[model samples]
Target: MVFKLTSVLALVAALAVTGNAQRQIQGITFAWNPDTPNGSHNLPKNALAMAPISDLNSKAFTCRTNGLNFPNIKSYSSTGGEMFIVAWDMNALNSTDGPKLNGPCNHWMASTAAGTDNLKWFRIGEVGYSAEEGWCTDKIRREGQLVVSMPNDLLPGEYIFRNEVIDLTYAGKTYTDDPTMGAQFYADCLKYTYSGGKNPKEVTTGLVSLPGAYLATDKGLLLNLTADGKPPGGKYTVPGPALHKQPNPGSA
Candidate 1:
């Protein structure tokens, strides 16, 4: 589902004309500080300012050509475990449909290329609906500090760390008539370069494309928060290609 620029512009225009209220959704602005050389002491003050446009397609967002600017590739060691954390801003504006939905379901992925336009992406991890808590409550609980780790065996190269949150609270029968079918997506792409891994083989399987990577009808995308017959133990099948298994950090 490649979204054309005109289509995106049209959607934005429609939202503007309809006077849709914007909800404040969380976003990932910083890489794991501990993995960086100087930690938080040297991190940028306004990381979100460097982020690409928040939209359905990851490639539509901007990328630093020089790869040395603010929010550029933050180096991490493949041997040592590291993670990227979402820096939430309670004040950031989002679609009104988000809060009405069932979740802050987190979807995280990595790609060897810089932009998501026609790029092959690999799923890293996902946190979907939980059965222990009710719908609205779960959304609020998952809104803070969403985190995902870089595979320890990832081949060293320039890569984009893509973090996405899907709100499905409005996915039930009541919202079937809604143009978006009550699905809201918030995505962020951060630049990164991995080094110090023993494996030299590149990961080639389990590749998927963004926009096309997810379908609104996918069970994980359109969920019934209050239904008792949901997947056992609330386990979710994230809507994307299977996670590519890279070799362990020290593997030959």
Candidate 2:
């Protein structure tokens, strides 16, 4: 179980709508199934009851024309639930022009704090890398055979495997008024519609895209995710369902 962050290809094409690469976020959507039975493989009630847990913010990974190494990939498990992973492409921040591909998106590590230790670990292979805008700053690519792994020992709740792209109306501070990320981007959380051990090709064809809504965020997308991706436990969850339903059978 290697929960790595290798997404982009599957969802970016989801949006048929086009936008400027700058100012407006372009080509991004939740890679989801369009045929799975609704209410099936829903997130655990508790997973939806909580807020997204993010320990870090505004990270950038860049790769140069000469190709750079993404040597540091890190992750963290929150007390709230869900393990958050982050790493740097190093190639992201170098030039506003963007990254040079056909290089390395190295295996990486991350830390809970800004130091050499306490950083969580993970691995990635059987994949390639690419970039747009800023490989690290704008949007990046994890070319062909993209598969990000998570620890098999994940908590039994709703989880999302997607990147967040926050957009702030730089009214004055640009981002200060809104220190937000993932303002608008789809989460293929529905992909988790089934169990987590199989290859994505095995179970995700007709499943509808799960609205990036967290079963937690009141915005929407609240549902159940069985430990086995089945129903009953596959029931839908409403806001604060976990508030009264304590000690639900889910985590991660």
Best TM-score among the predictions, by candidate number: 1
Q: Write the per-residue lDDT of candidate 1 for residues 121-148, one digit (tens) a residue.
A: 7777666555665443244444434445
Q: Candidate 1: global Cα-lDDT?
A: 0.46
> Model 2, residue 222: displacement in angstroms?
46
TM-scores of the candidates are 0.60, 0.24
lDDT, residue 206, candidate 2? 20
Instruction: Give all candidates' CA lDDT scores.
Output: 0.46, 0.23
| Tens digits of per-residue lDDT for model 2, 1-252 | 122233433232232222222211122222122122231121222221112221122221111101112121112122222222222222232225522221112222122222322222222111221222222222333321122234333233333233322211111121223444222221112113213321121221122212211222332122222333222232322211111111222432
